[model samples]
Target: MISKKAIQIFSVGIIAPLTLQSCQQNAVTNSGDADTLTGRLVITGSSTVAPLVSEIGKQFEGENPNVRIDVQTGGSSRGISDVRNGIADIGMVSRGITPEDDDLSFHSIAQDGVGIIIHQDNPVDSLSDEQVKQIFTGEISNWQEVGGEDAPITVVNKAEGRSTLELFLDYFALSNSQIKPSVVIGDNQQGIKTVEGNLFAIGYVSIGTAEFSVSNNVPIKLLPLNGVMANGDNVANGSFPLSRPLNLVTNGEEDLLTQAFINYSQSAEVHDLIKKQDFVPLSR
Candidate 1:
């Protein structure tokens, strides 16, 4: 049996979004009165970062009592747009900002290893980067060609606007290559579920989501990239082909809440949380 203290810590630490809206509202109201700062903080971006941000928001609200952090799951592009338009305070992304997003300050809070995933029953254990490029670019249509069970390959992809999709395309030099129209587009969870349910399907997801999927006994396996496994050590060493920075974009000019959150993110407490969430914390 789990100890009460352990269970409590787990509840507060891992089971996220700790309180409902009513309690949140009260906490916000009290904190606003005490700090004399009041407003809802909007954070939009990568569903990959959603759970982490949401957990942070819960903890931040618990501390501040006044600021309400509203988190949303739009793709990275939309998140950037929201911040640029002053609709959001922070934009979370699994990829770096483009040249056009020069005005907003980009803070990389963590690193994520993107993994090529397939159903567990699928015989393939690993893939070279070139083979991955071929598979995603529509060059390889049969699983047998890549040492997998004989079946037509079904490529599941994140939506076009997603940072994961953009990163994979750019990484593989497939930016100009046309993807077959049949590519299934979905969010991270859906992408994992689709691949888990279909033996012939292949997809990519962040390490955080992959961990969650595997924890839940989802029938999916993370394929190594160019023989290097997708893990924190490989990601930190730059051996993982799909490793990318996860960022929290803010206005360069620091504000109270923004600075507070940034400081908190670098704290030891949150660093452990980042690790528990299966992301590589940014080096101090």
Candidate 2:
């Protein structure tokens, strides 16, 4: 639950907008009263960050009754583009902001890990980093080669423009052209579902999303990455090798309402919401 101070921080001293700006054009609606904090924010970006942000948005709206938040998912790239192009009030980006995005303000709300996942029914508990690379590269097409039951491996890869895909390819030292995938997924849930339905399928997704699925009795396992467990605790402590920040990005200077939401999202008030999504909240 959010604290009173946290809610007040976003609700207090917010005057209604008079004129439409680039970010405010048609996206925000205001009540007639100047004292009321009434508006709508359109947030778009990483599918990985969408669910968590959606939950946070709901809580935020609950606190500030007059405000509305809309969260949409495409990929991390879309988030960056939408914010930069002023199509969205905020963008949910899962990866670290690169030098190319110097003009954008990135507010990191939490941490998550990218990890390899396979059906729990598979006997193979873990794979060496090299083995993972080989599997995706079609060098090891059969699960038997990795000590699993005899079956053709179903390779699940992330679609292009996804932060998960970029992180995965970088850590494994593989290129997109090198991957021979049976399926390409757009988001973490889709990847998790694909692996869940196919016993021989192997995919990668956010460790936080995978953990949340596992907790709900999903038939999937998050394999250790180079002997390190793929979980939020490991990411929070910096022990996980393939972790990335969950950020809310803004194109330029933010409106007062936008700034308030950003501050609340990063504050300790939303730690439980972050944990509920299996993500590691920023340290206070």
Candidate 3:
């Protein structure tokens, strides 16, 4: 569901709509010959935002033959640093830019929420926010304490530099140094797999990513936070309590190709693609 705000931005062509209005412009832009616009645009950032942005890049490349968009994932922090240092043409950040972020420009691409996950066999369907915080902080170390098995609780945490880790920590008002993780993972699937393979393990990741994997029999369940369901529908409807913006950041001036790609990402054309990847599209 694209937001009405995003639709207005896209309609007015904040950066110019990807849909050129005239057959003549299309003829020139897609002349069937090698486009004069040839450049490699590198985007590195959040694994959460990577899949959707990669899809956008692929679609954009198909329309403009000579443009090559390379998308990579490390974490949102890496994306911020890489773009600021000119190591990347664009940074895919799953979180908002801060006031101290040197005033870089960003385009909101989508929205996602951080969610807790546990093995499917675990009977505990949800935990209160305080309980979640205590679990990560090592204050609650046994399943029985949380109405589960008598086994010890295995905590899976995200590694440093990952935005997932950043948000999880912030949500619980915790510091990285305070968490006691039995295992640390980098991406959503890594965290999910860790929880899936360990019946007593509890971890967190993107709700959209986790839902997609669960539908495909990933053997995991999303834990409710503050008694609210963690799903795309809840997130889009603003009923989900925990959520974050997905963005693409550029340090300064962008080349024509880079700007065009950004416009394409923000356009209405990729709304379905964003949904296909289990993320909420910007408002239409």
Note the Cα lDDT for every prediction shown: 0.72, 0.84, 0.80
| Candidate 1: residue pairs that collide | 27-65
TM-score of each: 0.84, 0.88, 0.86
Please write out the lDDT profile of model 1 over residues 74-103, one tens digit for every residue: 678766776776666777878977898788
Model 3 lDDT, residue 166, Cα:
80
Q: Model 1 compared with the native: what TM-score?
A: 0.84
For candidate 1, the 10 contiguous residues with the lowest summed lDDT are: 1-10
Pick out the ten consecutive residues of candidate 3 with the lowest summed lDDT: 5-14
Residue-wise C-alpha lDDT for candidate 3, range 1-284, written one tens digit per residue: 22222111111102333322321122124334444666566676787888888778778877766666666677788778778767777888988777867668988989999899999999998898889889889999998998999999999998888888888888789999999999987788788888889999999999999999999999999988888889999889898888999999987677666777888899999999999999998886
lDDT of 2 by residue, 1-284 (tens): 22222111111223323221345573344467654566777777787788788878778888889887766667888778888887778988999978899999999999999989999999999999999999999999999999999999999998888899999888888899999999987788889999999999999999989998999999999999879999888899999999999999997678767887899899898899999989999887
Q: What is the lDDT of residue 182 in candidate 3?
A: 92
The candidate with the higher lDDT, 1 or 2, is: 2
How many angstroms is residue 277 displaced in model 1 relative to the true structure, after the best TM-score fit?
1.3
Model 3 residue 238 distance off true place after TM-score fit, in angstroms: 1.2
Query: Candidate order by TM-score, highest to lowest?
Result: 2, 3, 1
Say which candidate scores most in lDDT. Answer: 2
